[model samples]
Target: MGLAVSGGPDSLALLLLAHAAMPGNIAVLSIDHGLRLEANNEVALVEGICLQLGVPFTGVRVDVGPGNVQAKARDARYAALARWAQEDGVGAIATAHHADDQAETLLMRLARGSGMAGLAGVRSWSSLPNSDIPLIRPLLWARKGELEALVGDAGILAVNDPSNSNRAFDRVRVRDHLAKHDWLDAEALASSAGHLAEGWRALEWYAELDWAEMVAPDPDAAVQPALQYCVNVPRTIQIETVCRIIAELGGRVTRSEAGRAADRLWRGNNASIGGVLAMAGVEKVAKVGVEMRVWRFSPEPPRNAH
Candidate 1:
């Protein structure tokens, strides 16, 4: 296992626990996103701690692209970590995402009217972004305060990232609000997120079944393959099924995008989303002896060159 230590209280506590539990079997990996001047110092702190613990440490710098600094930094960090893990033949990577983080994520997504998956928040086990390497959060059930206490007891000084206190970030604002309110139970919220994650898994399973039963190939000899599906399932299932089809057609679509496309198709209108074109039509079902509504999803055609 590889531990992603960021020199923060949570991650440093994670490093301490993982080392205590696994000893020589665990390695430490850190990524400098190049967004903060303090990142190098943080990585150095982690490296120094790793040296004292007789654990191997590797740190790398990554470039974050434009647009959504936090999101891009996260993407770059995971990609770099995945690459490092692969090179080191590490089977899995563990990060310190505690219950407080999960609670904040749930609240953030809820404010945006997110669907089941988003409301589920950060999963305990997932894949690295665009990578098949296993990403595990061992601290998901732990609270942030507990981790900080653990680090404090261990006599380890953790890095305090100034950005964490910046209210300009939505997460920081949500964290501040949670901190100010004693009524809000972050642990309970995290548990709710876990339950939602299970529900989301069940929904995905049902969506797979719906896709197997209701969806079929268009049978048209076009450059891009198309999928046709009859509306036989419930609306939520229908949305999931359409999202799956859009993904299969090489279009990355969110649930909201799928829902909007489904709505347009229900109104006998064509909709385009994430490079996939959805068209609604009616077909005669000889077996049912009635006209059934059907939707076809295909890759959008290329625009004519200017």
Candidate 2:
């Protein structure tokens, strides 16, 4: 396994615990996102510790794309880590994502009016962004204070990132708010996020079943290919089914987009979303002995130039 270390208190404790448990089975990967001048020094701190522990270490530098510095940097970081893992023959990667992070994520998503999936927060086990490499969070159950104490007890000095204290960032703001609230239980909130994740998985499973039963391809194949979905199901199932069709038709649809598209289709109206066009119609279902509402999804055509 590969451990992602940032020389922060949480990740430093992660490195220590993982090395203690797995010994030589793990290697450390530190990504320099090129956003901070202190990033190289932080990576050096992690590297020094890795050397002292007799573990292999690699430092990777990545260029974050324009727009949304934090989001872009995260994407670049994970992409670089995935490439490093592939080259180093690592099967999986682990990161330090503890309960406090999970709680903040849940709160942030909630503030954004997120649905069940988005509100589920960061997953403990997921694939790297745009890659199939397995990513694991072995410290989801641990608290931030606990990890800090662990590093303190071991006499390990962790680097403090300035951005973490900057109120300009949403995460930092949330962290500050969480710190001020003595009544909020971050561990319980993390557990709630876990339960929501389970609910999301259940929704995905049901959506698959609905897709298998109520979806089909347009019979005429000479023109543009389209997917037809029977829309007589429940609203949640309809939204999930439409999401799958939109994704299959080469469009990325978010939960809110799917919900809106499903609503438009339910009213027998045409709607466009995520580069896909959803046209509502009716079909005679011999099996159901009735007329069924249907939605046909196809790629949106290029707009005519005036």
Candidate 3:
């Protein structure tokens, strides 16, 4: 198993506890996002800790481009971790996302008017996007203050990132706001996230069932890559089935787009989304009426007009 240690209180505590529990079987991975000069020194300090503990360590440097630094940095960090785990033949990557972090995440997504899946927040155990490598958050049920106390008890000095307290980020703002309210329960919020995750899993299961029954590839369509769906199901099932078909065709569509497409198709109108054109039509054969909605997906041709 590999542990992603950022030298923070939560992660450092996790590193110490995991090392003690699984001696000679744990490895450490630290990522230097190259965002600040102190990042290098932080990685060095973590590497030194690993060396002192006699654990194998590797440091990876990543470039984070502009626009939403937090989100981009997260994506880059996970991608790097996944690649390293694959190279090292590690099946799971564990990190120190605690109950407080999960509560903050749930609040942040709620502020953004997120759906159930988004409101599920940081999962205790899940896979990275587009990869099968598992991500485990063993300390997810632990509180941040408890972890900090554990670090102090162990006499371990950990590095704190300044950005964590910077109010410029939404997460930091949410964290600060939560700190001011003593009535709010982090454990309750985290438990709510877990319940929402279970609900999301049930929805995915039903979506798969609908996909199998109502959607299929249209091999005989005029377009090269297309999907055919029977619109005789409920509107929710229609949108879910359309989303699955679009993903299978290498096209992307959001929930809003799918809903809009369903509405337009019901009105006998054609809709285009993410390079996929959805057209509704009906054909009669052998005195029987057949209703079919064909969604044709193709890479958009280059356009000179801006």
Model number with the top TM-score: 2
Off by over 4 Å in 2: 302-306
RMSD of 3: 3.1
- Report every candidate's CA lDDT: 0.90, 0.89, 0.83
lDDT for model 2 comes to 0.89
Full candidate order by TM-score, most accurate first: 2, 1, 3
lDDT of 1 at 88: 95
By descending lDDT, how would the candidates be arranged?
Answer: 1, 2, 3
Q: What is the alpha-carbon lDDT for the whole of candidate 3?
A: 0.83
| Model 3, total clashes | 0
Candidate 1 lDDT, 1-306, residue by residue in tens: 999988999999999999999989999998888888999999999999999999999999999999998998898888888899889999999999999999999999999998888998999999988889999999998999999999999998889998899988999999999999988889999999999999999988998888887788888826469888887677788889888888888888878888988888888999998898888999986656788888888888899998
| Pairwise lDDT winner, candidates 1 and 2 | 1
- Candidate 1 residue pairs that clash: none
For candidate 2, which ten residues in a row score worst on lDDT? 218-227
Query: What does the lDDT read for residue 122 in candidate 3?
Result: 88
Give model 3's TM-score versus the native structure. Answer: 0.89
For model 2, residues 131-231, the per-residue Cα lDDT tens digits are 89999999999999999999999999899989899999999999998889978789888999999999888878888899998899977533376888876
Best candidate (score: lDDT): 1
